[model samples]
Target: MSDALSKPRSTPGTEPKPPRPVPHSPADDIPDGAQVLLAVIGIASAIALLVWGIPKGYHWARAQDWHHFTQWAATIDRPVHTYLAAHTTGLPITAASAYVLWQGIGLGSLALSWATGATGARLTWIAYGAATAWMVWDSSPATGRPVATALAALAWTVGSAFALRGLSLRPVIVNR
Candidate 1:
């Protein structure tokens, strides 16, 4: 027999190697243009919240209500540092500083989530829903419209859930 027929082509000892698995990439998992758009909107909204929080913090600080502001912030998951600072600082410092810290942290988180692609986009909406629910629950009594706030929160949660489906956990990549 010819050498080609008599010998195994791969090798005497080594078996054939399996092909390399394609590299898994987050960029490959982007769901669609809608997801990107939603991410942009989420980033924008987080930016707006940061801006809005600044003025509100300033107002509360001027009012000398660090204790009160801190209480509300705790409901919305403000970092522990805000609590420590609130205890140490006078109202003006606490107000401005807490706003910068809390909002900056929140916005930073949202921005990071958006940076992750489809999975991140879905996570952002889920986070937004939970945060909105917590904020509404915390503020409803003060706002004097518990029913309205509850309905609004429900609407927001539903809307966020609907938007979340725009992203797949592992999106099917269509090769053009």
Candidate 2:
């Protein structure tokens, strides 16, 4: 008998094996120094902003006159503040309070996102940093502190760059 006949008839169809998947490890989620710094900076900045903003928000909420609140908002010098002031002319104190509250929430979320290494946190952090940089650049000259302002802006930019680089890193978890 021929070798084929001796071996018995083989099936016409056979299942193909799938490629092996790469192994996943907890180490894959470890962030480097820059990412760690980004998280720390983001959390600290968020806390500071919240501390500074909360009282202002409370004051706005308690104030009777929206006009006064809007005026105060306009004086803040930030483009966002100015726009809010211009557009919320007839709104109640809640408008100002809501703006402040919104900032608090956004900052809080930003902090959490960085800490957790959330998927979109990097872009959000970068945007926040850029906005902060712009605000510093816009207002610092008036304070007569060009050098400090420049350094602050540079720091924000660097932080944003760190966030950008950290986009792919995930949150580290402890083994039980």
Candidate 3:
């Protein structure tokens, strides 16, 4: 009776708990070289456009070459100026030139946004979308070309925004 009472209990069927997954910190996500590359590409493209496009537009405007201006303006897909030019004489080269200048501003903004990794890139997309939409709407009475242009611009803006957001989320690796 004493031996039976002193018997030890034995139950062995349960498995051990598994380890949890490691949580990633921001620092772990983005590499420094990637960040620098993003900044460089954005800034370089913007600078190149500003340097090339603006001067050419200004020269065209100053020369008062309506035909060349009209041709270039047509490439932008805005209906108001193109339509007005077709119907009447003396198309506004100054206005078209101004529009080109605004585009340069957008390019600069995009570069700054990319370099700073701020919300600036998002803002640039919004601006680009707005401009593209305006052109589409203005050209609605015209042919399908303007609509296609608008769609293309919309795609570009959305793609760029995604790219920028992805870059922002990446962790910047610090070298010690």
Candidate 4:
């Protein structure tokens, strides 16, 4: 009672306290080496597909008289060699198996470009987006359910958005 009476009373009934500042989170921080490693892994994987997988696929397709017209070059989507894995026998390195590598050079270039801090970062997005589009088109069934292709496209789109956002935040330096 004495303390309350002696102390200056708040306006009417409300008492105002100092505003608390919002704390910043360092969780999003990524180390330079880690970023480089991630980029390298992505690039290397892509290169392996282009260098090894695509050539083998082309050869196989040629032997089997399948289309050899820029399969991976035109479109670099992942999750390959589905039919082979579905087989009852153990995974065999058949001609068809050679084409299983996902998102060949197209994806790899993008990774390398982003990793090395190369300029024109915005342009890489075209390849990033086109790959998903190509996959959607290639994977779509001729005349059946569209569930699988749709789901994959959706997932890829979300993933691409996240990756692109991460890249976009990077500081850009323009030469005047």
lDDT of 1 by residue, 105-139 (tens): 44554555455545655565567556555555554
* CA-RMSD of model 2: 15.6
Q: Pick the candidate with the highest lDDT.
A: 3
83, model 2: CA deviation in Å?
8.8
Which model is ahead, 1 or 3, in terms of lDDT? 3
For every model shown, what is its TM-score relative to the native structure? Answer: 0.29, 0.33, 0.36, 0.29
Candidate 4 ranges beyond 4 A from true positions: 1-102, 113-125, 143-145, 166-176
What lDDT does the true structure give each of the candidates?
0.59, 0.60, 0.64, 0.55
Q: Which stretches of candidate 1 lie over 4 Å from their true place?
A: 1-93, 117-136, 140-143, 147-176
Predicted candidate 3 versus true structure: per-residue lDDT over 1-176, tens digit per residue: 69877877555765556898899788667799988898999999899889998898889778884886565445555554454344345655666665565566567666666567567566775676566566555655557666556664755565567536546556899999
Candidates ranked by lDDT, best first? Answer: 3, 2, 1, 4
lDDT of 3 at 66: 81
Query: Which has the better TM-score: candidate 2, or candidate 3?
Result: 3
* Deviation (Å) of 84 in candidate 4: 14
In model 2, what is the error at residue 46, expressed in angstroms?
29
Top-scoring candidate (TM-score): 3
Model 1 lDDT, full chain set: 0.59
